[model samples]
Target chain A: MAFRASVVRLNRAIVYTQNGDPAQVLRALTYKPLPPPAPETVNIKYLLAPINPSDVNVVQGVYPAKPSLTSLVDGQPDVFVGGNEGLAEVTHVGSGVTDLVKGDWVVMTKAQAGTWSSSRNVGVLDVLKLPRVEGLTEVHGATMTVNPPSAYNMLNDYVALEKDEWVVQNGANSAVGQAVIQIAASRGFKTLNLVRKRSDIDELTRKLKDLGATEVLTYDDLNDRNLTQRIVKEWTGGKGIRLGLNCVSGPDTTSMARLLGQDAYLVSYGAMSKQPLALPTGLFIFKNLTSVGFWQSRWYKQKTRSDKENLFKTLATLIGHGKASPEHEIVTIPAEDSDEVAGQKVREIFAKIAEGQYGKKVLLKIAGSE
Target chain B: MAFRASVVRLNRAIVYTQNGDPAQVLRALTYKPLPPPAPETVNIKYLLAPINPSDVNVVQGVYPAKPSLTSLVDGQPDVFVGGNEGLAEVTHVGSGVTDLVKGDWVVMTKAQAGTWSSSRNVGVLDVLKLPRVEGLTEVHGATMTVNPPSAYNMLNDYVALEKDEWVVQNGANSAVGQAVIQIAASRGFKTLNLVRKRSDIDELTRKLKDLGATEVLTYDDLNDRNLTQRIVKEWTGGKGIRLGLNCVSGPDTTSMARLLGQDAYLVSYGAMSKQPLALPTGLFIFKNLTSVGFWQSRWYKQKTRSDKENLFKTLATLIGHGKASPEHEIVTIPAEDSDEVAGQKVREIFAKIAEGQYGKKVLLKIAGSE
Candidate 1:
């Protein structure tokens, strides 16, 4: 079986001979064909891929993991294939492969580049079986591989919360926070959500509440020290909060730490503010507080094969039962378009995400079927 | 059998009349007597009491728990009693008390005042049997009730550290940190100790190392970013740290958080700096870090009776085995001296402590030993 792939012939990716900023950094161009899948590799017909903030970071050379430069296409010296993971259909299985058949939906389970292309070959182990669910579409599966799992593992691994216990998280409107709200709610736990105050905060709050948030609050609510204290006291019945999730660190992180009960856990995952976290020592000494960091990539890599299998099974069950659904915006790009055009679209969408303009994930449609 | 006690009568505690503080607050006068112990109370012959920071906070009307005002004394008003808990010999058991016997060494296991006096009547539940360990003095026993237990619980409760695992803590020169160093070492765990750069830091580091510190360093060492990273890499074998104990919050907390591995726990228990904790959110999201607060008093209050008893037994055994000892400075106050003289001595010692001239705990020795 043969399919055309927008392979990186050289290191050059999304290049323009005429250079400027974003317009020049990501130059769309055509690339030469790549070799077929080798033994133990499966050629995937890329269906859709999500334009994530980390993807933008990767292009900017700030991401922790960089794609290997050796895999660049022959002619494109400055360009490299960039997408981390995406949903696809099995086009051709290598001689050694037995698990996946043609037309089976799969997603990259590990760090794999060239996901922005129409087709790419990846190791069998790097691909996860995407069980077909009635309501979940290809776009949903494309976007489901990262943020949802991050939220799921963080809430489940840190603290074994009771049904009535509360989980307070900043960035409540983000995809991960939203997933957390839903997953926590489904597990019989309550969520106290914190998001930036917008003109449509009430509507946003309503949306989140409908998604299983017990309480939706703005950063303004957390900033007013007295009101924050009062709200925390009332909500926690003076027992104080048990778990505080923070992505927006700064004064807000310190405030979250203060509002927690004795021995409460504060888990931080992102620094949207790019500011250092300032927490009071009293929170540590007098409160017996524990602060820890979480990285999904590292956590997933560290998990035993059995644990990973169990997690995937659990996630599959949730998706199959409609308890967990991806909230995504799908943008279909034609397979005939140059690789540069597709890269530009992903970059534009990611820029909006970086600016906090986009609320939902942006999925790039690659396979014509999707 | 009634024994003479230099009790601070209600409404007539010694007070500082001026903001100049020490000299002004030294006056002590007589008032009416306190009521006898209530039912289920045990009258204790106060053997020794240790002056603690909380006691000073209380005298300044800054402590959280405020004592009630009463006119049972000679018409004086607004008087406050000092002392939290102390080692006492059971002198008289009230009607409902069955666990305590006369001549047994006991310590107040709960919040109480009036330990400065020769005797105090407290609830039987609020007192614990102090096992007779050879060479354990009453002064040492009084000091043992808080810091040692706090260190023990903080280290044991937060991380399930293995024998070869390392525990890092700041304020290594502090009583609690020192205790942690010893306890962790005795339990076959290594300690990466961080202390302020004092004039006697070398001596202090040596002493701490003798007590169980694997490596003793100063904040200056942590200030060099590259050096800190290298040290962390070497200490953890590039795997990352497991537990970080912080009492000094602020920018220091951020450093501590950064040094931790994924899913590592940072426990805070004290704030000598009186500064808020500032940390980056990357530690939370990317590192899977957890920050939690710890309060020994609150923890003690919440434990079951049997658990409390077991802790005491374990602590006593540790002390008996010479694994732990309270460093103290005993200051004897004659019972025959006027209340004013006794008050002056306390004020002088407290002044020295405030001035940072004292290296060990101040133990008040009340005259009239059994």
Candidate 2:
């Protein structure tokens, strides 16, 4: 038998050599492809990746976890890969790998695994093989790991919120907030969503309601204390707001906190408003409220592999039942693009994010599986 | 046997007919004596009562729980009693009473049972008879139910701090703070006490150290980041400050909250600053810290009779070992004086409290027990 022939393919990646503005600090490189996977390793073809706000922060070097910079990729400056969340297909697998095979779909398990590349080789444990559902799209699977899990854990983990119990959340238009609404509705829990007022308030409210939000209100509605009290009284049946999810801090945080019942928990996952959480002293003393932080990344680090898989399966079942779906738009990236062209495209997308031009999650489609 | 024919002795109590400043709203009144104890009732002769801040708030009608206004006390306006905590001796028991005789010592178990009186007729269940200890002075026993139990529960209930672990607290000079320092020391837990800067910083530090405080620093010392970090590192041996007791709020709250390790709890029992607790957003988000409130009165309502006795016994054991004692000054109220003269004396003591002239706890010695 003749020996197998080897073929060389050029791999391109977006990276940053130093932390700064993404437009100024990020670059693209075309380099030699990975050699054959060693034992316990797999080579993957990048499919779909989401350009999350946190990904931008990672490029700016402001994120808590940073990607590893390396000199392994020749003809390029030592750089760290730019994205944290993405979908990939295993194209090759080493002999010792037992959990995955060629053609299996996977996503990066460990954060900062450099998913911004067209293709890469990683340890089998570095990626989690996802269970395929008949109608599960790559966009849903690509973005599912972060925001959906965050919302899911926040709802189930904190207080023992029974059926029909109410949860309140601000930033209700964000991806995580929308997922919380749908998931809570699926679990027989009601959600009170607070969104910032805008020209399209009516449109946004309708959109969130369509996603199964129990009630949607503007920040102005929160100031109408009598109205808020009436609504809460009627909706919760005097049980009081049990759980609060705060991403937009400042006075908004205090308002939501005030609405909570005795011993209620306010789990904050993000502070998008750049404002500090101003909690009133009386709330802490009189209401006996508890304010805490939740980081899905930290939780991920603590959970076992089967634990994660079970959670993913639970999410998949919800999606399969048509109870949950992420609103998103895909921006396709050419697989054979030049270094400069790809870097330019990445910058433009980030600029749009900064400008708040995109209302839904913007995902990157590289190998075109979506 | 001679029945000891009944004598009508006048009962005097401090009362509040309206809610406002303590000086203007409170009054002293002499009223009709108890006819006799009904079955399941007992008559208690008051010994000592401590003036707590909550008592003042209750009289002002600002507190959540309020005492019932009534015409039960003859010759007095429709009003409520002026105190919440005190030590008393059982003077008479009803036919159904099995737990006590005339000499058993007890304290009010329910709040707003009109404790600040020379004597009271109540259901036997309204007071909990304490197990007498040889050296358990009226001063310690009268004050034990509030500050000591508060410090005890806040230490043991919230966090499972192991030996050699650390707790940080502001208001180290307050009654609860002093109790915490002593109790934690007895349990082999170290404390980092934060007090306000004063002209006698050295003297106050020495006094706290004498009470088994691991380290005592002024609020200015908290601002000295290097010194604070070094002290925490050395005292905790890197376990980090796991529990924080906050009474004084405002900026001091944020500083103490910042000192805690990951997933630690800051329990706010009082806001002595009268300013709201101002917590930074990052502490909640990054450190996973929790801010909550502790109300001993509420906790008392939830606990069983045995639960309270166990805690009291634990505290008495500590006190018996000279491990804990409340820093206090005794103010005598003449037992044989007329109502008007006793009222004048009560007003004088309250004036001293308002003027901040007394540094330690002020206990009313109505019966000269201590």
* Candidate 1 chain B lowest-lDDT run of ten: B10-19
DockQ of each: 0.53, 0.63
Q: Write one digit per residue (lDDT tens) for candidate 2, span A260-298.
A: 888788999888778778777777777778888888888
Residues forming the 10-long window of minimal summed lDDT in candidate 2 chain A: A1-10
What candidate 2 gets wrong by more than 4 Å, as runs, is A1-7, A69-71, A74-78, A323-327, A355-357, A366-370, B1-8, B35-41, B69-71, B74-78, B95-101, B229-239, B323-327, B366-370
Per-residue lDDT of candidate 1, residues A1-370 (tens digit): 3433444332122332322233236544544443567998887777777777776767676666666653445554554566776888887788888878878888776773657666667888887777776666666678767777888887887677888888889989887898888888888998989988789998988889888899987777777888777866787888788888877787766766667886687777788879977776666655656676666777667877557666666766565555545566777765555565666775576567667786666776653322
Candidate 2's interface RMSD, please? Answer: 1.4
Compute the lDDT of residue A302 as modeled in candidate 1.
81
Error of 2 at A324 (Å): 6.4
What's the CA error at residue B106 for candidate 1, in Å?
2.6
- What is candidate 1's TM-score against the reference? 0.79
